[model samples]
Target: MARQPLAPVRPPCRLYLITPPHIAHLDAFAAQLEQALDAGDVAALQIRLKPAEEGDIRNAVQRLLPIARAMGVAVLLNDRPDLARTLGCDGVHIGQEDAPLAEARRILGPDAMIGVTCHADRDLAWDAAEGGADYVAFGAFYPTATKETAHRPELELLSTWQETVEVPCVAIGGITVDNAAALARAGADFIAVSGGVWAHPDGPAVAVSRFAAVLAAVAEEI
Candidate 1:
């Protein structure tokens, strides 16, 4: 199927932060999150806690949502529309194996943002946009330990999606300050990072600031 072109994104890309799979100390992480937010322009924060009990997810959301919201960053829960709605999250990110987009919309309502993981498949991304997802995520663009997924999308895919869809696209998985500029120039509206920011040697704040610098540089060149 042929892809359709949409308006070009103004000022290029921004940062999207994802939580480390396990946030053992909510209070400490909350402080770290605040520092990162203060360091740069963060558009959203995804609370992605894996293999955790429902209560733990809820607790993390309860502690972190306010901080994100206060910073004017959207808060998205990973894979739990029910909890997302119940806890008043700004949105939810649903993977292919997770709940369907329709169900998530029904749970989150029209105003809430919902993003879907489309991996490296343009068809999936097209379907997701057609299905009313606020954004479609394509990724593992580089090697990543954050999660295991076989699909590794190329930088060109971002250009294709940008030229085709009005709905914004996110490039995630193993993205970091070092390699993020390529994705931005390729037309990703947002670059989602997990360990790239959270586990940076200089710390999350430095990571975010560096990413912001990269995005700014790319925006100018593109």
Candidate 2:
């Protein structure tokens, strides 16, 4: 039998709910994940495990994968391609400082989703796409308390990028449900977030659901 074509994973709607390493309640995290899935704005869940330690990340993947998979949310492990494949995550996200895109693709195989961080430069994004990235991330569009910006991308870059690249484009950096529509209008395929969902006063589940709603709202307008 011929191999079936893989269904395309669309870019995140308007809001991309991100997972952080710190969660006060494990059950709450899972519940929040369920809420995000129910909300239906999510494109993928990036499991950001910092400090690049194997045991630490493995533990995180073990805890988070079940929740994501249960909800049919694609999981992308940050910075560690090997661990991502090992943990059965759908993809790996690499920063410019992390690993090469070709390297990531080679390890993850042809069909695996691999994302790259290109910051603000259009040329960089083009390079990443040529290098075999499934998606390209641009960020620090807004000041983020979570991670300091090394290079900032201009808003116009989003429009330019959307036109240039066939691969999905992700706009990251301190995005919240409130501001996500602008990015969506600018043609971002995905909106990567870190603190927005996790740091919400309403709690993670509400945060996730809220972001999801925001994304849906944006989609309706389009």
Candidate 3:
């Protein structure tokens, strides 16, 4: 089947934030999220609450989505298209094991931004893009404890994808400020970060500021 070309991403590259695998306090995290968004430009936020009950996920999304949306950040829910649509999130990010892309699109409609995890396989990424994914995520470009994945895509993958694909590509997994510039230069449309920001010694705001600085510097050089 012929694939529909993805809409081009503006500004070329940006930060994509993911929540900690677990959030014990929604209010505290909401404050931190606001600070991070305030400190720099973030394109989107993924409410990734693994192992949490549906009610807990709903609560977190209700509290955090408004903060992100108010700052013009898109909110994405991980692994649950049904809840994402039901709870009014901007989109859902589906893993290889999650709902099929067609199903997710059916549930959320064409307007919803649906992203698919392609791991290290260009073939997988092509499949997702051809299947109508809004963006295709490739990772772990660096080692990560955020989630366990066997595939480790190299920096060159982003470069290659950028050269060939119209769909935006996201570089994820253990991406930190010190190393993010390389990905930005390599042509990642978005850098998906979680522990790298939340676990930074200086704090999320400082981490976001540093990442923004790196990306801005890279943008100038490009």
- The 0-to-1 C-alpha lDDT of every candidate, in the order given, reads 0.94, 0.78, 0.94
What does the lDDT read for residue 22 in candidate 2? Answer: 57
Clashes of 1: 1
lDDT of 2 by residue, 30-75 (tens): 6767765675556688988555567767777788788778777788
Alpha-carbon RMSD, candidate 3: 5.1
- Alpha-carbon shift of residue 84 in model 3 (angstroms): 0.6
Each candidate: RMSD: 4.2, 6.1, 5.1
Cα-based TM-score, every candidate:
0.95, 0.87, 0.95
After superposition, the stretches of candidate 2 with alpha carbons farther than 4 Å from their true spots are: 1-14, 21-28
Cα displacement (angstroms), candidate 3, residue 12, comes to 3.5
> What does the lDDT read for residue 198 in candidate 3?
97
Candidate 2 clashes: the total is 0
